[model samples]
Target: MNAPALKSKCLPTYLVIDTSSSMKSHESLLNDTVDHVFDVVGNSPRVAEFAHVSIITFNTDAHVVLELSDIETVENLPTITCQGTTNYGKMFQLVKQRIDADISGLTHDGRRAVLRPAVFILTDGEPMDKDWATQFNALTDASWRRRPHIISYGFGTANATVLGKIATKAAYLATDVDKEKEAIVSMLTSLLNTLVASASAQEFRIPDDVPGYTRVPIEFVD
Candidate 1:
């Protein structure tokens, strides 16, 4: 019998961020974190050469702050703001729509490609949105052809159990609340490095550094 074949990849990466009021306390740090992440991902030759980056910032409402496209100039990304509540439902639904659009646009006539859409969501509080389970399930099930890779992180008393549920795997936690701002910034940089590195190699692994990084109970299964 033939062994399973390796799949080809051209994964278009997507970042779904949480910019809720809970982040207001760490607004300055959050801004720096996002800025740094963009730099890390956009500046890397591997990511810049092959990956299309899309950024989605969510609060009480979800919005597509940026769409799927090659980021030739990372500086061109609009400055994101934080306000409103934590509505995971809005975020999941909006992202699902965008994923659909991307898959819909793909043409089989092109090279053999696998578009792995990845999402990285960071937050510091509980969700304020109702009926989030519906959208969350739809996204985590991997029914979409783009098959998303979602990394959700929580900090400062966020419900690890709940966030973990949304993310498929347990969510990572930035446990240093007293220094939560800086800690989150560090995680952002680290995660971006992982994303870009994966894009460049066309293959990747989670927790590339081999540190458990305080991820949630759901992730413990791994």
Candidate 2:
């Protein structure tokens, strides 16, 4: 008789970046930091084995820069171009669609057991679409079993109130406008650290603190 296969635990992690025109100034830095992050994870055998990563970018439209995959398998990292307006509705809709497809694919044939996904969003400005919240609500519907835990990072002119509303797990805002480079580095570093720790702990782990940023309080209505 053949032995039964053991399912490996998987974490679907998404990095959702805002590539609006305002972020053009930091485009090169953003691309470099993202590529560095991938390189670090790809080299770490344990983290790479546990966390499957995807990259999503949003501007006038949302794009899947990288599909969820083993970090080591990604050959070429795409260059992120900053243009167009920040459309939150499009971003949220695309994230929801990708999550549905990703979760299903991960669990196919019971080869892997997926945990709740984690979404890390970095934005430099307020959303241009007025009805973005509607799309957000649909993506984060309480009834939906696959809804991800969202963590938002805001810098430049990003609205704190909006970041608070968008984050299901936590929100952060950069403290110094003069140190934009440092802030970006800190955010990406924290993300990499979170994945490394989570893989070691065998579960999802949020960073306790992020330098150059302040945690935003999330508002809840009864």
Candidate 3:
């Protein structure tokens, strides 16, 4: 009789980006940074093995740019186009849906032990939808077993209060408006560093502080 294959733990990581009109000016840089992050993860065998990445972009509506995939096997990364309004409600709903589907797919055959998903949200503007919080609350409900650990990055006209509410783990807001480009770079860099560290530690880890941004205090309801 043959021995059973050992199961490895996998992290379902989502990169949620706001592709609203406000981000149009920095679209090229945004796409490049996203590609770079993927390249770096693909280069690292351990990180590639542990972190299954997915890309979700939202503007007037939300779309899944890439399904949860093993970094090493992905041949081409999709580019993000900046347009439309920033609909936070749609984004949150899509994320919740994706988390449910992705988790089920990952654990279907018992081949991999799926860890709690982590979502990295990068946005440059405020939510256009007033009822966005309803969707957000549903996505982050503590009673839900697969609720993701969300880390949000804000820049340009991004709202700190909104970021604080959106993030379950950590939130960061740019301190200087004049240095928006730098802030974007720093946010993506911190994400890459967090992934590498988490993979090595075999657990999810977030930076205590991010450069060009200040950590926002997340409020909890008792």
> Candidate 1 at residue 60, lDDT?
75
Positional deviation of 194 in candidate 1, in angstroms? 1.3
- What tens-digit string does per-residue lDDT give for candidate 2 at 118-211? 9999998999989998999998898899999999999988889999999999899998546777888999999999999999998999997898
Candidate 3 or 1, higher lDDT = 3
TM-score of candidate 2 on Cα atoms, chains taken together: 0.95
Candidate 3 Cα errors over 4 Å, as ranges: 1-4
The models' CA-based lDDT, in order, is: 0.68, 0.91, 0.90
- Residue pairs with backbone atoms closer than 3 Å in model 3 (clashes): none
| lDDT: worst 10-residue window of model 2 | 213-222
- Each candidate structure's TM-score, on Cα atoms with residue i matched to residue i, is 0.82, 0.95, 0.95
Misplaced by over 4 Å in model 2 are: 1-4, 109-111, 220-222
Candidate 3 lDDT tens digits, 1-222: 985675688999999999988888888998899899999999999999899999999999999999999999999998889999999999999999999999998887464578899999999889998999899999989899999999999988888998898888999999953678888889999999999999999999999988778998876331
Clashes of each: 2, 0, 0
